[model samples]
Target: MLRYSNRSIFGIMEGATVFYTVESNNVTNLHQFNQELRNLFDRLRIRAASDGSSRKFAAGNSTGPYPATIYALMQCTPDLSKQDCDDCLVRVLGDIPITCYGKEGGSVVAPSCFLRYGISLFFEPTDDTLQSMGPPPQAVLPPESNGANATIINEKKRNASRIATIMVVAIISFLILIIYICIYLRVMRKPIGNSETTDVSSADSLQFDLGTIRVATNNFSDANKLGQGGFGAVYKGRLYNGQDVAVKRLSKNSEQGNTEFKNEVLLVAKLQHRNLVRLLGFCLEGSERILIYEFLPNKSLDYFIFDPTKRAQLDWARRYKIIVGIARGLLYLHQDSQLCIIHRDLKPSNVLLDAELNPKISDFGMASLFVLDQSQGNTRRIVGTYGYMAPEYASHGKFSVKTDVFSFGVLVLEIVSGQKNGRFQIGENTGHLLSYAWENWRKRTSSNIIDPIFKGGSTTEMLRCIHIGLLCVQENIADRPTMASAVLMLNTDSLTLPFPTRPGFFMNKFSESYKESSEFIQASANEASVTDPYPR
Candidate 1:
């Protein structure tokens, strides 16, 4: 049987659909069968609806003489609230009399809950269930003529056998655990590259021969070139195994030296997350330093957000997803990863998108590794793009996770407004993107900062993102939210955000200086940074 109700689950407003089935045969003893099934259902329901429990599934059998046993299972969708799960199961259970009462076997399936029962076992017993059953009833040996003495001797023998078996298993388990720990330590401590030199010969497994890369890129032909950055040019290449890869061939005279190149290879290879780009391998032959990465078909965020025609393709949903993705990626870098990394040069161009438009943070050349306990660092040379740079870092060379947070804020604003950070112009009014967003936000006209293309998008979500962006770009370093807090704000709608302070570098005071500085950096060979001027 099938039924539909005007009740919703999992955010779909269409309602819930339920399907049920029952065996043709009926139990001989309806009272006993009903009692057993009821007990089983109660047990399974409690298991699936228990508070603070991660498990949403339960299965077991009830003993009965009428049909020997009744195996049953209950399951609820993981996202459903405990109360919702109980209510759904209760409604489904109420349908038993009408659909499958006294039947030998039956099943009810719904979007949020499932119920199944049979005369025979239909599912594997889980470990918990097995443990609940305890060890199988010990084999009862027939009493010998010696009676009590034989019984005592047999019990002692069984005890000794059990103890010996347990000891053997314990020893084997300990040895296995030790072996695993040793293997883990060896892999964790494996040398990434030569500490004395930039050569990565120590990481033989991740080394790619120059000949292979040359063949893949067709001897560095211009046709395969993807784009040029501060470090070098990237090329689209096909390996011998039919896998497409992005090959980054470093420029010999580029600002990124052997140290930065080695750093990129080491950091990227060890780091792995869905939001971060995967580094496949690298080639270190002669003066050529090439790094291979998984090719992302959609290219970088800048390719779409900055282009008028392409920006149309990114609706509010995709834009919000990209913003959230970048936040999670930053959170992973700053906290979740083994090394607390600060990607000093985070910008739209460094945020690559895969075929599905999922954001993946890339380019670790300017990233810094920080100890878990370390909160900040200083450098004499201030690197990274101008508009995205935090006020403290740009002026005082003080950087921390907040530096990346500042850049993320700018990127979020850009995504929401579909405008670049350096110069934001709307009609006669013109200023930095941060200034524009803050001005409108302060005036309760935050909708003005949203892209006009998003005609019917969620205004509230866009405004919230803009608010988060402002919070990130606060002039005071301490005022900026950490990536973790930013991520929480983006995900949780109930979170009440604190009032934002003035953003760093607000207004056009530094507009001329920023432009001049950007131009100078672009012109000067030694001062040049990877801006990724062209779309990938």
Candidate 2:
């Protein structure tokens, strides 16, 4: 049996719920047990809040009496900040006097942290501990009945071993021959001049006839239109096999040539990750350049996150999940995938949500491919939404992985604040979101930038996200964390984050710069395309 208690203490944690339970059995030496428990709690608190540690969990034991040992464990969710975890444990430690005094075992549970202690061992031993215990003894077999029998057995074993070796060698040789033949055939079939031609030919199996797509999308009717972007319109289609797909029909006036479009389709089709939208097939017939993707039922993230009424549906937990998912997707594109890719345009509108609201990054029309070792690239024609592009990329035509990092930072701020980036207005103060966030962060009033709807949310987690966003949008390219580092930061609470510098294009400088560039381009080549007026 357990003695349970629930308390709502405003002083300890405002509007936070605390639950605790204690074993009914009383301890014989209450004083000794209490001292041991207190020591364990202190140690766990320190370990959980240690700098640069990814784990927020710790377990240990303390000797209590002649035969009694106190096994204690404490943990805070990976999302909580180090200071927040320490404070939470301190609060719970204070409650032991009221909840678990004189008890042999007890547990304290809170929203973001929990602790438990018992007289007996409750967790499995670590691998090192098991190794320290030594290996189990092996059973000894009885001596052989006779020397003659032993000799016969040895002879038979030798023959069996010889036969097994011969069979293994034969199998390996056959496999090698088959592999060599396959490689030779592949080399012979590969085209010599253009490797991209090979990529297109290999993707021929994924090509769909125009008639099939036309039938699936009901001849591109208005009712089947899902959304429209600079590239073209997206239509919901149902194939004859009862499979649903999202069809993207590229505009005839697209500047990308037929070969470049096909190459992009092939590259995108090869990318596979849970956080990335799957490319099913493509159609390149005559003037039509179409790509088909797995249809998502819940639509894009912008549908919910930007709508005031639907924004509430995404609480702090959901929003944090989306942010982490997007970071992971970017990490995969940048480092994990076989081909290094930079998502030139990453925004809420380009991120689709599945039935469970999990994020799947979509839209690769503006994506740039990089060699495995290459870190940066230069492009003359700039393409992406305003307020999301890094200052260097927008003004100087220099693009890199950090360019996407800046856009991701803008997206993170938008998700947390539930407001767009450009032209962000707070009461009478009208300015860019980056400048406003930087100002609030410098003044230690970061909470002012958070959405008011998150009244009961975990303030520490939200503030940490804002801090990470600032880190990503820093003006110095070297200061911006890579997507991998950003993901680690999102999941690790105890890590000591570096101080963020001033964000690029602060005070709405990007708008003016982009406008000037657009005007210049219009008068000269008329090639630049600014998809969205403001960040999505």
lDDT per model, in order? Answer: 0.74, 0.74
Look at candidate 1 and tell me the lDDT of residue 202.
36
TM value for model 2: 0.60
Off by over 4 Å in 2: 1-187, 191-198, 366-373, 508-536
lDDT of 1 by residue, 119-178 (tens): 887654435454323354555556675687777866886676566457634643454455
Give the TM-score comparing model 1 with the true structure, all chains together. 0.59
Per-prediction TM-score to the true structure, in the order listed? 0.59, 0.60
Q: Which candidate gets the maximum TM-score versus the true structure?
A: 2
Which pairs of residues have clashing backbones in candidate 2? none
